[model samples]
Target: MAKRGEALRAAHLRYAPRKTGSGALHCFVLDCSASMLARGQLALAKGLLIALFDRARGERVEVALICFGGARAELRFGPAVPRWWNERWIEPVGAGGGTPLEAGLARASQLLERAARRDPGRARHLWLFSDGRTTQFPARPAHADHVTVVDCEASALRLGRCRALAQAWDGACIDADAMLA
Candidate 1:
């Protein structure tokens, strides 16, 4: 079963860019609110993040991570050399605290800005994984070339806000629950 899971994961890693364009620097903003601690959501989020990191490696896309919880945001991974991301380094995300979406987004924007300065040709994308239960929204940074929202909310009541935020930003919203299915 483990081997089969590895095989499936490997197969899923083969993602072709939808358009022939310059490579992008992808920054993932993850919400680590206490709510995420419900139902093994943190583990799932980490797995998805690792998978995305593998895809970024394959596509030569730079990657970074920003985690928000407890009224604070932190950059757990980098705008450093892209090779630094690995399973061991990314797997231990814990969930506790209030959702600080604004702070997370701001940190992500800073990372993206720095990456852009370091590599002007690379496109910038912000992929946010959240339950969207925050009291505040980050002002969308103009530097984000594209935004993708991964909604981890499973309950009907928890679903709408994330979707609404995604729509307001004119970005793509993916239901993480559906992906798990």
Candidate 2:
């Protein structure tokens, strides 16, 4: 009894409150197509990525990055914590080739579905940063709890594809220019 009482010291009694956003996951689908390179869209997208990462870091949520361009979609980051995240890490992600929108969404869907199978209670949010240059209007990721489409198109003649997709998916569509301001 004396030893048990000694173990309950103030030094070992640190209060740890349960955080509401603890199990939340944020999946970022970045479009690194050649279209994104035009009008500095890729640059803007990269800036937004940094900000979003910072926000995720502040909330202590897990994040995954999937970049699509040229011929394929690649998982650039993780469905893990952004502990050592930095702007320089995204510097080598060059933009070129066709926009593989379908491939990117498919990859993200696979990841989210797997995550769902692992933890059904975990909240998954998908953030798609794209110029909406592709002709393919793929299906929305059902595994994702929420979705946000950031339209990076800055051309004079807007196609409004991203906005339409966001509406169809019942998600938010934010303009890239407005996000920066």
Candidate 3:
């Protein structure tokens, strides 16, 4: 107004752009193979998920869920805020058939890629909850800024696939049981 020194018009009025802080997105990949149903690992995982979702809600982070089993992988939720997340939503996700680890990872990769393109400034984190029962090894998603592999393999004779994956991807590896504690 001072520079113009005249009647202000809509074209002359300048407003500074507001800055919204970069947000975060968390994508969780869960292995729902029949193996997970053994020893109640799936149930435990669901419990952990509830806890994690609560934490994400408190932090105001967006979340997505992908479950893999029965020769396929499905996106159970969205990359949006889980406002009404609850046990009822997770209860119907039953386990069966083979562990299609590669399929699950590929789906997550696609989702992360789309999210990155939509909001390049948003930070992306990938969480994998698996029993490591699969022989397939998938590449890490490029769009994920951080990755965490939750090793759910509770068998006495461990295969150590999840640890191997974490090491290969240079990501963090955490035990499922330890996470509950």
Number of backbone collisions per candidate: 0, 0, 0
Clashing pairs for predicted structure model 1, backbone only:
none
- Candidate 2 residue-wise lDDT at 8: 69
**Which one wins by lDDT: 1 or 2?**
2
lDDT of 2 by residue, 46-138 (tens): 999999898888888899999999999999999988987777898888899999999999999999998888777789999999989999899
Q: For candidate 3, list the clashing residue pairs, or say none.
A: none
Tens digits of per-residue lDDT for model 1, 1-181? 4355465655455555444336777889999999888766777788888878877887777678899999899998775436646677876778898998888988887887777676666788899998777768666766788999998876546647788888888899998867666
Please identify model 1 stretches exceeding 4 Å from their true place.
1-22, 84-86
- Can you write out model 3's per-residue Cα lDDT over 35-149, one digit (the tens) per residue? 9998888998898899999888888899999999999999999888878778899999999999999999999999999998888878899999999999898889999899999
TM-score of 2: 0.87
From the highest TM-score down, the ranking of the candidates is 3, 2, 1
Locate the minimum summed-lDDT window of 10 residues in model 1.
Answer: 12-21
Worst 10 residues of 3 by lDDT: 13-22
TM-score of each: 0.80, 0.87, 0.89
